[model samples]
Target: MTDIARIRLLTTVEHSLDAGQQVVSLANDEDPLTLKDRVGSIERIELHFPHFTDGRAYSQAYLLRRRLDFKGDLRATGDVLIDQLIQMERTGFSSAVLKEGVDPTDAERQFERFPAFYQSDVVNETPVLRRNTPES
Candidate 1:
């Protein structure tokens, strides 16, 4: 399993998703852009929550996966905690970028905090087929 790592920096939303450009995005609080729009062209999105208490990025990540079906890389940066790491994965983030000055090795151990599966209410049963007697 190859751990996803940050390779580049994207300063603007438009620039990040543009077909002509591929840059890692870091969103700020005042960006005023929805996660749906941001992920449309983004190759990878990094949510920047200035504080742990700030929950906007959580919602953003959720929308990216649940609503937009974003399959590319997703990461959380800034003010991340052990408590939030599992929720981050549940919300559809593929990776987490430890805050500055933190050791990246420690994060690999954080995976134990979250359960592996999310049960859903929707169900589909396999259809059964019965053969009818041949007409004589």
Candidate 2:
């Protein structure tokens, strides 16, 4: 979960990505890399969630958008649940790499069983704002 760990993961993966900029996986604990410091200036960011019970990547992705203003591909990798896809999209993820052996065809169908929006007042992992209101 350290920056070094993230860098190591990035270096290990080989894939056809967005473009000249590196397409790399980042750990939740790693400090966000600024645009200038990134190799070839990162065009695609793959956020890793070590487990479904761990949601650090969601916050990482949110910060990348709301704070750093990253306007490129955001991909969720590892321990992705079918139920979380819509929220992931809402959180700014453009794509997801399903865990090994998870069927793509069944993912969407399974996802529909969960409510698209929740009714809650808490702000934590997967914030559900304005839950008290009827619109929520």
Candidate 3:
């Protein structure tokens, strides 16, 4: 398993994050590739989910990490749930501000239950089975 930092569960959005780092927030529909030019100057990007059923933000995170090469923090905000934490991290979200009333401790367990994945994800491009296999 790739050593992903523990997913943070913020009760509220911290407007001023990380000691003056430039933070940008994007609506679910916004295209992350459009920020390619500004990626280097940004320290964090928050992608809103709006509703648990709305998954556009996942695509946004993937584009930011794999296409834009955004190395800084990628945060998921709004409608965040314990069910989404694992996929969020796999898709490049470093943290999340979960929806109101969701227990942080319960959310944390989602990672423990499934520590490793067989499929490729943004953090690990190589499938688990192919990772150590000799080239055909």
Winner by TM-score: 3
RMSD of 1: 10.2
Q: Against the true structure, what is every candidate's RMSD?
A: 10.2, 8.8, 2.4
lDDT scores in order: 0.56, 0.60, 0.84
Instruction: Please give, for residues 6-39, the per-residue lDDT of candidate 3 as tens digits.
Output: 6666666453354455889998988788898899
- Give each model a TM-score: 0.57, 0.61, 0.88
Off by more than 4 A, model 1:
1-20, 24-40, 113-136
lDDT measured at residue 99 in model 2 versus the true structure, 0 to 100: 63
Error of 1 at 89 (Å): 0.7
lDDT string, candidate 2, 19-130, tens digits? 4455777887876655435533667888887888888887777777666767667778778777776566656676677666666666666545654455321112333564
Query: Of the pair 1 and 2, which is ahead by TM-score?
Result: 2
Candidate 1 on 1-136: residue-level lDDT in tens?
Answer: 1232322222234323434344355565533245556666777677787899998887777666656767676767678765666666655667665555545455555665543333421010111222243546
Off by over 4 Å in 2: 1-21, 33-40, 110-136
C-alpha lDDT of residue 70 in model 2: 72
Candidate 3: clashing pairs of residues? none
